[model samples]
Target chain A: MSDANDGAATVHLTLDEVRALAKAGLAKTGLSPDHVDAVAETMVAGERDGCASHGIYRLLVAASSVKTGVVVPDAEPVLDEPSPALVRVDGKGGFAQLPFRLGAPLLVEKAQKYGIAALALNNVVHFAALWPEVEKLASEGVVTLAVTPSHAWVAPAGGTEPVFGTNPIAFGWPRPSGEPFVFDFATSAVARGEIELHRRAGKPVPDDWGYDPQGNPTTVAEDVLKGAMRTFGGHKGSALAAMVELLGGPLIGDMTSLQSIEADGGRGGSPIGGEFIIAVDPAGFVGAMLGEHMKHAEEMFDTITGQGARLPSQRRYEARRKSLTDGVDIPAALMRDIEKLLEEA
Target chain B: MSDANDGAATVHLTLDEVRALAKAGLAKTGLSPDHVDAVAETMVAGERDGCASHGIYRLLVAASSVKTGVVVPDAEPVLDEPSPALVRVDGKGGFAQLPFRLGAPLLVEKAQKYGIAALALNNVVHFAALWPEVEKLASEGVVTLAVTPSHAWVAPAGGTEPVFGTNPIAFGWPRPSGEPFVFDFATSAVARGEIELHRRAGKPVPDDWGYDPQGNPTTVAEDVLKGAMRTFGGHKGSALAAMVELLGGPLIGDMTSLQSIEADGGRGGSPIGGEFIIAVDPAGFVGAMLGEHMKHAEEMFDTITGQGARLPSQRRYEARRKSLTDGVDIPAALMRDIEKLLEEA
Candidate 1:
């Protein structure tokens, strides 16, 4: 939040500095070399894209899981192609990033050959945003929808207790130029970190964000966190959350959010589950007309932006551009937390 | 709507009668024999499932399209397989239902063989709820996601003018027994018909529904119809709507909502475009564990219903059960409208 080098709450750091600090902190937890690199890449990406909660702040959570021995840092992911268009990656209870990295190529190849394909990452300790996954695939000229369930921290619409996760759905579309259009969003009214931030600041959340233990709407962030969080757009958002649970959970042979928590045994570590990512190749569907259709999409974007409306991914792309040149800034408090993780061992 | 067919303004009819009337009315429009049967089935299903808006009321829209030559009543849908797992159905500018019916078997076969498959229906006049499509596939024991863009009537979250369609997204997951878990919803704050109903009744909608011509949020339904409608849940809904546009439009080599409107040339008929449906076979992913995973899904459903949180598709299934026994009701005014359509030449 600050560019000044003075003693401020916000501290400025170059991209390289962010990477080195992230690597150092993760390494302190005995993360495998290649796995650490895969995980650290997502960390740097989060900082570059200004998703601070998903940035180096997650290193503490990773270290906590490491302390619990929940994540298999050196586990080698096993890939299985049960059917022509389906690629399943068994993460062997390790971090998700490496498994996705190892399986994405097969997903791409399948989509190229079959017009559409899906990658299922099972038994992974997931702890990061899904945009990095979709973003990388979109850069490879594929349209994708990626989803995963988290802890059972959210409630279904019209329900009194938690029955679903803050299940996030990320979508990516390859643009003819510039950054490919992308969005990664939790189906909940807001991310869990949002309520946490509100509670940390002693602030009241919006009425729609969550509910009290009785299922009645509440503004107190801490009470709601202890109770249940609502989904965005009411029942429609809840339906999407259910889809994420079904697809990323039982559909792909993995744990549901409830099962994930049950498996954690109250340790409160990162959720160990599965992810479902679907990729589509434009050429396979359109043959030679891909260019003309792509131009039409460009016009659609222009119409949206020309009317003073912002695309969902525009801000992150802007932050990414600026961060590439101007580096990034983090709270001094967060830096202290990272230092604590490094000091633990 | 009333169950009393006496002197009141409502009429009651059995499912059989509903089907007969629907078939007669569609046939009166010179619709092809097979097409009439296929379209009539959806009409009956809509009425049986208590989706009154999508029920026999659509006969009027179908008749209007027939009069305008926008829908080719005799059009025979053509199917082409461009890749191993992609089935493209060209509706030849006919209704979407028939094309989907003609192509569904191929989609199922592909999903069975490849683990995942996609069906893209192009150049069709879609006028029904997507539940029936997903429900059909879900009954066949495959998971499905279907999306289609309609006429441009909704605005992006930050924009004032219409740039996107209602853009419904539907999902279906196979349950262990009984009906599958299914949901189909528009990304808009509410369906376009809701606003139209409010306008006809001279009622004020909620503030969240739409905006005035100047982009100010307005409860006046008429003004919003003339201006722009907002997506649900602010930016998150807008992003999902955009995903629908991209996937149902350019990615499938079909017209965007804007292009569909431009091509409509103010006829105000149904927008002709594409529908994208993805089918995933559970057995391909889970193999022998399918039954075990399915039992887990049942437990998940129990958790949902145990909390008094109704599943998205529960209402329709309930209506279906009741309708099969008692029948459905409609306003006398709607009956007269259908009579007028049938009486036209």
Candidate 2:
């Protein structure tokens, strides 16, 4: 079976079939069927939402982690409810998504009681793209802010050590259109995933995206292996990455990016990768305020974009709409691999 | 007195003297003494905080707005209690800073109760840097996010039109150190204020900080008149600016940038400016968790920067500490001018 980067290869599969295929791939690793479904569901949704790097493409990495016992299934999460508005969850070496799925609902519940809820997860795997969870809350009229400290793969602004991950932040607000508005991006010049993909393809990276050892810009992904990933916009992006590390890493007890690289195989343990999620119930704060604000915001967004501007989640919503109408767009290479795995299962 | 750009040079009065001078200047314009003092306090604090662009230096702009009836001093803010966590304040043609001050305390109060509070403001003259207000809340163990939209003076990623303002987003989070981590920055490459300052000083703008009319990079501020301000990181910056416009503009019933630019005098009587602020009480969610998380975060920050990485607010905090002990570093030229202004007053 070929991969998407293997050139002109794309296989079409229905959303259900894709989900099933992903589940089967996960199941092949001797995982419980339900958890497998959840992982596959998230991956497929990620692919459907145009986040290919975080989508089914990541299944191999997850499988590898499972085989290495880096991802422990059936591990119970340690949740400490410190306040009505905050919960701290220790992943206890389980699948990262499970704790997040469990914690998000609990956070929303707490937010409903108060006006906001903050949940921190330690000892969890990377939760992939942070927007999906945020979007789910936004749809329920909750404004959410999510941050995560990633595996060490990015360098600071002026350094040459991949001492920081592509630390990302996701912010979302509920809207009247039910589509909501969400913004999520890494603080890196380019996400580390792109670098990995480039390396896998034996391709050179864009000079602007990263730097080689000695802090010189290079187009070689393999060079990034020895050097560091540059921050976006120099100092500003570096500052943001630092803040994310503070908020998402040690603040939540996750290993620092620098420490992650020092770990064996670069997979974080102890405090699972730190993730912080906050949900605010607009109705709780201002009642119909969010609704009114949404109405006015729609007008403003409309006026700005005029003919062509779209909101953050807008493209994804459009993609989803199109998918529901004409089925999801599944890459051919992914489908073939999944089919093979399904048959093997 | 001649303006800074009028070749009159900057007058760096003692912080106390600067505030008094601004108050006196406002008082001469038929503003109530209290209103004069409030506005002066905010403006002066801006300069003290090293935000010279929005600081006491902008007194000229503030005076012009008031004289032109753009900033009404005696006007009262129309307050609406939409929910326990949200408050809407119609600036009612008042000084933007005035309403912000009034709303800040209210937000803190509500945040303490609801765990999260949002205050939206519309129909006011420009307010200075938002960090000060958010920082005040952070001192009380609250996290704050503030967004403001101003006149359109920036372009989208690929376009050449200044379709958005150098809109800024300010955020604050409290750490165990009792010093809050605050970030305030414009979505544009370099804020128009910074560019104007450079232009006034006949200094060239930094490459990658701005572009010329032909979409070419230039350091000449004069070129900005013909060209447009480019977004910071191409598409990412543009997306962020658009997000700020939506969440900070129409979301607060303020006019969108496009609409304001289309209106009379580009902004006069436009009532298009908008502000959005959210404050969340950590006690509401995490209880004792904040201490632990923040301590860990500080440790991480220290370790990462042990190699000399600077966090977002580290410089400001250091500067502030120095200023308090050894006195703030006032530019020699600026100091002389301020002395002259004092004698004249």
Candidate 3:
């Protein structure tokens, strides 16, 4: 490993090396070999794509979840097609990736046949970044929208108490001839993990990011972690968060954000919630006009980028390209923590 | 009319009186009887629900569009089912309500059979609020998501140029045994019409609402009208606006936001854009669990509202209920404008 210095020490490791380390660390948690590989692949992509919070930083949590029996290491998801265009997957208390991996092919097939399809996952633990799932579908030429709810950490616009999750939503649009455009974001002003990272670094957040424990706006990250995160865009972002809570929770027969938190008793592991994924095929509706459609989209992109505007995923794509050649840089402390886990295993 | 004095002259009129005025005012625009009725119903609902920007304030523009040969007053939309779960409508240059009125029933029917359905409208001039379309579907126990793109009025987060539309999106969810929950909002920090209203009233807007012509944030509404509106949640809202642009424009073989502006030669009328609506039946997947699903959602609403957090559309519903009894309050100046149009007819 090579060390890259900014203010803190960071270690650069090849993608394959990181994947091997993740797999080795997770395998000892009693996960099946296939489960271990799936989790490792997801975390590797997270690191490669520059989402450090969701990358190797989460491996220890996964291991602890397995050891605490919160996540069943060898559980299998059951897939059912309730309708021609609707799929339901019961994750059976397993990692979210397992269900998505089991059901994505079927979702693509249905979308190809029916023009659109919806997949709902229940009783799943979503621990990875959401973009990988939608981006994978987009790679197969499918436009996808995915959403999931976590523990309640965000407050409504005018209220002080937490009633919603960070509630991330992801969208994927496939280009006619190249990589898909993907964007995933938490509806809150800032992701909870980012605040935690700020707190760990002993830094203050922006005033708009969250409220303190007394329900007053505060810049202290530690204060915000003890209080609640504010939704982005005031009332509008709050509405979107509520939409995710409804779609991912009640609509899917799973736990709402508050329910998830209460049930888990804040064990600091992945929450047992639901995920909703919808896939649509452009060719299904546009048919021969698909090229024209894509051309128009490209024109919009060109006009915007020509004026120096960046698309949501443009920076991530650039980071990924550089990582492919220069390797992924992980925080030196986190690298040490993973190594300790590996040694123990 | 009873005048309510508050800085400006406002008049209270019964819902029936407002609908009658809207129907009479729209009838002179060369629209067919059915088209006029549909437009009137949508406008009346907008006023009754307290969205004054989308209510009587827009009648003059709608009539002008029809008179200038931009909107085809009598044209009929043609509905086509490209797939079992997809319904396509060609608006044939008509008012937007025509297409929804013609295709919504089909969308509902198909959603009943297929568990999910999508309606794509092309060449439509959308001049009314979007909630009506989705609210109608929710009334029939169908969950609906609707989106439409207007002319370029919003700038990308980090860019100065206007490349995206205000691009409103609406979502509706039906309760098991009551009125549905619905919300509609523009991706921009504030709707363009509201800014124009503020300009008319000679009031300054919040600095975050928009930018001046020099790409600097400004509170002057007139400068914002000359410049561009900012997205609500910065990059997140900008990404959503882009999503609506793609889904409603290129994906449906229609014009992009800037393309619509150029096509109209900046006539300041409603643009011929596309609309996308998706409907899903909860019972199709959850079956008997639908009630349980709704119970969880109600609990969330209760807990949030109990803590004084208002859900989206809660105020709208309350306003509508009061309007049904105490009548709708409209600005006297707007009422006079409508009466003048009616008198000319």
- Number of the top candidate by lDDT? 1
Interface residue Cα RMSD of candidate 2 after superposition: 3.9
| Model 1 agreement with the true structure over A1-345: per-residue lDDT tens digits | 121122467888998999999899888888988888999999999889887877877788888888899899788999999998999999999999999999999999999999999999999999998999998999998999999987888888878688788999999988867588999999998888778878877999998888888878899999898889989888999999989998999889999998988888988788899999999997878999999999988888898999999998899899999999999988888788788777874
Query: Model 1, range B1-345, lDDT digits (tens) per residue?
Result: 221122357788999999999999999998999899999999999999988878888888899899998899999999999999999999999999899999999999999999999999999998898999999999998999999998888999889888899999999988866599999999998888888878877899998788888888899999999888899988999999989998899888999999998889888888899999999998888999999998777888888899888999999999999999998887798899888877877
Which of the two, 1 or 2, has more TM-score?
Answer: 1
The TM-score of predicted model 1 comes to: 0.96
Ranked by lDDT, top first: 1, 3, 2
Interface RMSD of each: 0.8, 3.9, 1.2
Cα lDDT tens digits, model 2, A170-251, are 8887777777788888888876657877898898887877777776788899787567777786776776677677667654
DockQ of each: 0.86, 0.32, 0.73
DockQ of 3: 0.73
Angstrom error at residue B309, model 3: 1.3
Off by over 4 Å in 1: A1-7, B1-7
Which has the better DockQ: candidate 1, or candidate 3?
1
**Cα lDDT tens digits for candidate 3, A1-345:** 111112377887999888888898888778888789888889888788787766777788898899888898998889998878888899899898888888999999888888878889999888887899989999988888898989888888888778888999999999864668788999988878778777877888999888888889898999888788999888989988988998888877888998999989867778788998888888777899999888989888887788788988888788889898988878888888788887783
- TM-score of candidate 2 versus the correct structure, residues matched by position: 0.84
Computed on alpha carbons, the lDDT of every model, listed in order, comes to 0.89, 0.68, 0.84
Each prediction's TM-score versus the true structure: 0.96, 0.84, 0.95
Alpha-carbon interface RMSD of model 3? Answer: 1.2
